[model samples]
Target: MNDSAPSPTDLLSVGDVSRRTGVSVSALHFYEREGLISATRTSGGQRRYARHVIRRVSVIQVAKRMGISLSEVADVFADLPPDRMPGKTDWRRISERWRGRLEARRQEIERMENELVECIGCGCVSLRSCRVLNPDDELGADGAGPRLLPEIPTD
Candidate 1:
């Protein structure tokens, strides 16, 4: 093997990326399937990803930790220039959007904390707490399911 450094445009195999980024090959494939990342095929039909995918995968990891969903990540990526790797400016744009989402989530958590404090003296049972939270079975108005919770679409 030559001792020369690889070029910036070199493509990485799925396993190589997985090893470098701590993301599994299966997850990489899933990201590609979800349009969060893209890959090109070689003459033999093997998937190869641009080196920039490492940074992209790292961003995906951080976003998921912050409760950003894959669809949300895809939306953010969609706004970036399609012909190039995401630069600092592109990341900053997405970061600003994510900041808004995190701020909203923080406010929700604070509201829940205050509600729990209010419940402290009630000695409320599980169902009682549900009733107090739901108030007059309001969730039932949503057609017999947990209305406050988001419904996940299944494949």
Candidate 2:
């Protein structure tokens, strides 16, 4: 680390944010336009951001990994104000709101695994009685995907 480089505790310039986040400067500008993040502007119109903003956008990236939409994440952010970065308590609160959703998705995956196992076990290769079947018809009719594909798990 260069002695002249801003400390992690110091506010990061737009270039620093880009370097640390591996997000290009242009994209960061786009994020600002999309209202996903904001930065303070210097008198010369340069942008400066709290180092915590890097963490915020990192969190957003991970959420997107789970198939969350940007608007949905914006809605999540809407629940809390930006003046205070989320501390552990705020994190737990936010996570609690998502816990049910996470659980539902987890259960869906587990059920699908069970269905495939059952299909193999029954010797009939039918998913109708698979323990994983959602009673609400979540799987829909047989036309969905390869109905009985027991491909080698992707490890």
Candidate 3:
């Protein structure tokens, strides 16, 4: 038996959390500093977060990939009370709130699909003939991507 005293299963340190989440420690610190995620402090004042932080970090990464800013992502989780770890139901509710956003994205993709199909059979890339190109229906002149693509709501 190779047992010494079994090593203690320590809680995830800030660095440990970063390694697990593939986010840099500085970014983890930023998340905490910006009030995005919560953590416990040791007697030495080092930050320790629950393992669930992996999932939270994953959410943050996905939201950022979707072009959501940190402040905006923080706003998404702001109403969520951290005293209770979000279960599937809680997460589902949060996702449900984005149903409209997802559907709008879906619709925009469909519009592009039709445009692409049209372009394949005919030489038509004109904004006048394409819903995807003429995305003014969804967006104003402010952001990137198709103007017809609606902006993701910030609130």
Which candidate gets the maximum TM-score versus the true structure?
1
Candidate 1 TM-score to native: 0.75
Residue-wise C-alpha lDDT for candidate 1, range 1-155, written one tens digit per residue: 44443343588999989999999999999999998888888799999887888888998998988999999999988887654578999888889999999999999888778767777877664543454475466556557444567789999
List the pairs of residues colliding in candidate 3.
135-147, 135-148, 136-147, 136-148
Judged by whole-model lDDT over C-alpha atoms, candidate 3 comes out at 0.72
Tens digits of per-residue lDDT, candidate 2, 1-155, equal 97754454587788998998888899788877878788887788888886667877776776667776778667777776674466777667656766766788899888787666755646643444444444444555644665456778776
Give the whole-model CA lDDT for all candidates, comma-separated: 0.82, 0.71, 0.72
- Candidate 1's C-alpha runs over 4 A off are 1-9, 125-132, 135-155
Lowest lDDT block of 10, candidate 3: 1-10
Q: Where in model 2 is the C-alpha error above 4 Å?
A: 1-9, 109-155
What would the TM-scores of all predictions be?
0.75, 0.58, 0.56
Candidates, ranked, TM-score? 1, 2, 3
Query: Ten residues in a row with the worst lDDT in model 2?
Result: 125-134
TM-score of 2: 0.58
